[model samples]
Target: MSIVDRALNVKEQFLQELKELPYDTHSIKLFKDKYLGRKGLIADLFSSLKDETPQNRPNSGKVLNELRQFATREFEAKTVYIDNQNSKKNIGDHSLPEDPYLIGGIHPLTHTLNEINFIFTKLGFSTVYGPEVDTDFFNFEALNIPKHHPARDMQDTFYVKNGIVLRTHTSNTQIHTMLKNKPPIKIIAPGRVFRNEDISVRSYCLFHQVEGLYVDNNVSFSDLKGVLNYFAREMFGQSVKTRFRPSFFPFTEPSAEMDVSCIFCNQKGCNICKYEGWLEILGCGMVDPEVYKSVEYDYDKWSGYAFGMGIERIAMLKYGVKDIRLFYEGDVRFLGQFI
Candidate 1:
């Protein structure tokens, strides 16, 4: 056959093979070698172009380029098809059920803290914060707990260098607030506090506290009761009942522990309430004169009420959580219950 006829025959065979090419690595390689490899049909046809008659050489070159282009397009298309098929195999069946994805949620203590802040803010108390590591003056002495006072022994303190300590309560923020501004101060401090204590179902060495302070002329224990009662109703439920038991604290002259009727027992007997039907929630009293003296505020001109509550304790009471330790443990099963 003439060179032109020979090239046309090879072109027809190449086009036929291209159409039948299989979707797989081995099939693609074989198809390429058969028609497009260095020594394959298309390359050999191009090599023969120089031997063709001058008039036919132009026609031969055009046909050879077309053949080359056709083979290249078919090779790329097959490679993409094969790659897609392999990827689908590696991914497995689409109908199969997927493994569960666990979503995270806020911790119970944090949720309680936010709720407490919201309640106090509604009562016109601005949120304030202070250092977790504070000096003895601010953490203790400035709050009227003296170095020689027996009340100092009440808090199992983690003392740091040079009379500084990890604050045992958020009340340290009270001193910081008072020193910075003059009264009509109404603020709530919320933050983590550290103590030296054994971890137990009831207590942890580290916990959260929220302390509220409101200073102005003529502030009284009745104002304290009114605010806390409103907080109890907002926090627990509209029907929650609250009372104050006489107590003592170095910073507050006439301290009292506030208690709410147990929601679990509805004021009836229950282990959560120790069968007393009441759960102590927090402590409150008028700010002590000594505290004002330490902060250099005139005790005669300014009086306020300060109250504090443990966030963990409040969370435990609200959620019926039996163990304080569970709050710290990173158990997904326990935490997932909150979500």
Candidate 2:
């Protein structure tokens, strides 16, 4: 046959073989050798061009160049395909089992605060929030903790300039709420509070508190007891026992601390309860007349009750956590237990 015909046959055969090239390193190497190698079809086609007549040589050379270009393009594409497949194989098998992805959870203190909020909200108490930083008027004076009072010593406050302070308790929310809204106000303020204290298993420089306030005509200490009793049962368990012992706070007259029977010991002595079989959970009482007077409320006309509890303290007692520091430390092993 003519030189052009022979080159066309070789080109057609190479193109057909190229179409069947497998995407693998070994198969790609063999494909290169068959079509584009030194002794391959394109090289053999060029070798045959020298045997053609002068007039046939031009057409044969053009056909040979076309075949060379086509073979080169096909070989490069196949080489890239095979290289990518090998690279992916070297990287890893996507189908194999993978290490589990860790899931995140709420911090223990936040979790407890949410639970507290949920309980009180169910009891007709709306959730309220207030500023962390405040003046002595709101944080202390409004709550009947006057300047130079012994009660100020109890808080160990982190005071800022001009008598402003990082609020010692969420109870400041009570003053804010009363001033803005008339009586029949029921609110539970849950937020972070700061104090000047040494860090230890039982105490921290900063912690969370939930302050509850209920005001209206004839609001009584019995109402405070009933609400807190319900809270203790809801928070601890339906069977949890609670008691109120007379305590003192500048804001709440007839102030008392509410204690829950040690869950760890079922009211029997234990290290968790300091072997006393009782753990103080919160402090509460009727709003003192002075607190009402400071807020410009007629103490006789609008009586109320205010209660406050430490969120970290509640979390520790509920979870059997020994160290208060563990709540703040971002240790996965310790925090994961809550989840």
Candidate 3:
């Protein structure tokens, strides 16, 4: 008989057998083994295609493929029918309640970022984001961080080719926002930053940051201090005390680091605070005229303030998490505690 005729005969036989087949697990499994197993009839037919005449092989192959597809479709439908029948027969406890699936929660870092965003949003600052993979100008030059600047040493940036890099800080966004928009801008940048640093309890190679910027006709140091004071109070507690000590940053001429009295030690000093009564939370300063010059903003026409905090550090302090590495590791037990 021709291959097509043989295929038709096989399909007919399968249809007859399917009509008489018992709808049970054992019968359906045997049916699958006979027709669709690795060494079953369909495989044997495909293997035989190589022996057919070259000119005729295509048509024979088409018949065999159709037979296989038809058999597969019928087999799947039968299996599903049998399964449904079995399910109805096996209904032993319809009254029993289902075991509840566990619900997940916001990661501690995310929770802290949300809290920071909430506080800023309430203060008339809108959230903004920038690329993790960024250019040297936005990441360093535009922020007034030079190629050989000592501040570069602090970030330990991961360079990508000539002028590209994994952004070392969300401050990159400050430059981008300023360049794209006219002044009277207030924004908070929240995103991941990369650093080539040795991993330890207190530090990790990857972390998150929230950087803030405000530029307008008249902004000042006092305005910077007020915003930070409000942030510390809202994030920690209404009673938490903050301090700003003289510090230096490449992008800001008059820079200071903000610290909050250690909630863990209540200003008495502890290991978490490294025996200091304060925990450094963020860095802030008046926007340097040099930084404005890079973005073509008239330094004479505008003044602004910028501040940034490491989100991981904030989470560590707020949630009492010790190792920064724990935040990255997918440890359900550690994460579940936050929920």
For 1-339, candidate 3 gives per-residue lDDT tens digits of: 667777787788788888888986788778788778888777777888888899999999998988999999998897788788888898878797654446778999998999999999999999989999999989998888877877777768898898999999999999889889998999999999999999999888899999999999889999999999999999999879999999999999799999999999898889989889999999999999999999999999999999999999998899888889999898999998977
| 35: Cα error in model 1, Å | 33
Stretches of model 2 off by over 4 angstroms after superposition? 1-101
| Per-residue alpha-carbon lDDT of candidate 2 for residues 1-339, written as tens digits (9 for 90 to 100) | 876677678777877777787776687778788778999877887888778888878877987898789779877876777788778878887897664447678888888888998999899999989999998899998888888988888869887898899998998888888889888899999999999999998899999999999989988888889999999999999989999999999888899999999999998898888899999999998889998887788887998898999998899888888899998789999988877
> Cα RMSD (Å) per model?
10.5, 8.2, 13.5
Clashing pairs in 3: none
Model 3, stretches more than 4 Å misplaced? 1-101
Q: Give lDDT tens digits, candidate 1, residues 143-198.
A: 88888999988989998899989999999999999999999899999999999999
- TM-score for all predictions? 0.73, 0.73, 0.71
TM-score for model 1?
0.73
lDDT of 3 at 52: 88
Total colliding residue pairs, candidate 1: 0
